[model samples]
Target chain A: MKKNEVPQDKSNLESVNFKELCYAVDENGEYTTAHSTGWDPKTIALNKAIEEIHERTENAKQRVLNNTTSPIEYYMELHKMDLPILSSYVGFWKWRVKRHFKPKVFNKLPQKTLQKYADVFDISIDKLKNIADGN
Target chain B: MEIKFTHHQSAHCENGVVSNLMKHNGFNISEPMVFGIGSGLLFCYIPFLKVNHAPAITYRSMPGSIFKRFAKRVGIKIKHEKFSNPKDAKVRLDQNLANNNPVGLQVGVYNLEYFPDEYRFHFNAHNLIVYGKENNTYLISDPVMESVTSLSEKQLEKVRFAKGAFAPKGHIYYPTNFPKELNIESAIIKGIKQTCRDMLAPVPIVGVKGIRMVAKLIRKWPKKKGTKVANHYLGQIVRMQEEIGTGGGGFRYIFAAFLQESSKILKNPKLAELSTEMTQIGDLWRDFALDLSRIYKNRSAKEDAYNNVAIQLETIADKEEVFFKALKKAI
Candidate 1:
């Protein structure tokens, strides 16, 4: 990519006060560093991934609302985490985490286990126990 | 107490951190030169390892390998430590800062408050430096950022001990000694040779072969996994290549820049010529990424979008195979 041709498409990065630094060839064909506000292709790809995360979060929220799944599922998606990742953070086995996704299994859990999940999600025990309306 | 440090932004985090740290210690090493000597360029597609719900695709070497390799080649004695507990990590970092030393740290990107929301993921290989602490905030020199920033003690600790894959458990490193002068010519040759060997490795999951493997998988994904999963996987490829701090074109441009700098230092005009060719190849990778985004975004008019992109990747792989061969012969 040439220095002049570096993409400056405004992106989500602009909201966070960051600009990506790209290496581009200058007019003399020498490599130089250039700051890009964003590139369209990258933005599109990133947005798609984020969209998927949001969709999952929404679906999980619905499941929790119906009492089919626990709030653990909803909060996991809200934090952009999957079962394996959430398991690692909470120091729980994969099977145990999968079990916790069930409303019955999660409700019977003790304070210590709930505390672990609460800490990993950075939420209070009450918040983990109760999903606020419209959230 | 804070050590006086100057920040220089680079295209990649590890290169920038190493370059900036070297400068702080009175050694002026450019980021490209550091990257070259460290042999940071690589391509690996780990099918068994899932990151972000897609197969892990890495465009560079494992995290911290660049600094480790660079320090060894250039006769720098570095001290590396990892803490099982955050308290010990905090103590050691404070000790380094108290002694007027700026230490490099391996941190996760997810909890880094200064990072853009779009870029914040579960990636744990990001590097930065802590020069000093004031009150409760630590002065940070994240080389990817335009200017230096600060992170609170709590925020810093959270990222330092970030869990999951490639988790950096409070890792801290700094150079303890440096040679009177660097062996630039010898180091450049070693770096180039190692990079060539890596790119041409016989392994199916690494180097040029790995790129080909990804291409093959792309061709099968749509039919085997359905369009939704296929597009998600494709988006993962694009994100790995273009979204991360790859300096554009998945570190191809950076490698090319390294070659251009090496050409002058090694007095080999052939390297300069190859550098231009590499740039063209980098452009091709960029094109590949663009086409991929189009397909995932449902904007592609091409009938066989997945197949077209797969072909494009194969073309890139073929070019890279030839390019690495020539790069090896050039030195």
Candidate 2:
């Protein structure tokens, strides 16, 4: 029940984290590589939730970037934001995107080290590739 | 394990109105220096059946517990069983040294394959401290025979109880003394400290030049153009606290490991040290997380499991029992 609702379902029940966003958008396990029943549920949910909320979260970011005065306006401009924070208020997605989504700038380093950080934060390798390719 | 110093000062800073109010008083006094140790700790490691009782921290004389008060702070009504204050509540609180109450307790039953007969040993208690005048003293419910010892049998007699079953449970002592376990715990601390240090790294670059370097890549959004910076800052701090909290748990794990290491290790060493640190760090982190979690979790919604500090700590002990069963396999 975020102020700015987006979408909600078992598909989006993951924590609103970077990896969660990437997973939700995953039409299939094309990017997941292999099965991992051994991972912590929170970590797993975070990865999938992030994937689901990716587009809506980005859209919401764009809206907020444009303008934000009232709560309604704030919701309209953002993708996810539970206006009045609630525990059971699960809808559209909890407006926890900003908490998990942040801009990262890494130095030119070996691919292994960079990938480790991504794994720690559960950021998608493909997204890192996109960022690297952009440069 | 090693913990990051972070300026060697953990005293909370209160500015603006809080600072102004302090000026009204004569001498400068620091508020309770709150610290977040870590979560998923094993305060009471029992290998048999146990009970997870919710630890309740209140004014003792006050109605309900801190959980209820926190609910009140957030403007929510919790239908608690209203009870009249106990006449001994004040007397007990006065005699006791700590200002807090039990958060909760845990109960669990374990099946031992070694013992064909499943002897059920249920633990029904919680750790608490009586308030101290200066920094405060720690209150440990039980002292393991083979880990560490802070209080000599003589010192145990000197301690007094104010509110709960601490006196009835027993004195604090360590039963483990193996140097290997201590060294290992210390190494783990070092590892944790290193991880925290690496995480604290500021922006890879600084200054306008660094900004330009970053901008050359991903387009930078104007600061606060879309979101409130305060929220993000708080979130980052929360995560940082979580990382360092491992140190808090490492402190206890070292103790558990020591216990596993030997009966000889626990004899004369200062077990009270471990108990004190665990109680101190546990109280600080558990206290805050309980409040914050309530807001983050239940909110104005239905009550959740272990939502308050007392209940949460109780759950920790229960989880520890889980660890104990799993850890037995290690032995």
Best by DockQ: 1
> What fraction of the reference interface contacts is present in each model, in order?
0.75, 0.00
Estimate every model's Cα lDDT from 0 to 1.
0.90, 0.24
**Clash count in backbone of candidate 1:** 0
Model 1, docking class: medium
* Per-candidate chain B TM: 0.98, 0.19
DockQ versus reference, model 2: 0.01
User: iRMS for all predictions?
Assistant: 1.1, 21.1
lDDT of 2 by residue, B236-290 (tens): 2222222111222222322232232222233423332333333333334434333
State how far residue B316 of model 2 sits from its true place (Å).
Answer: 18
DockQ, each predicted model: 0.80, 0.01
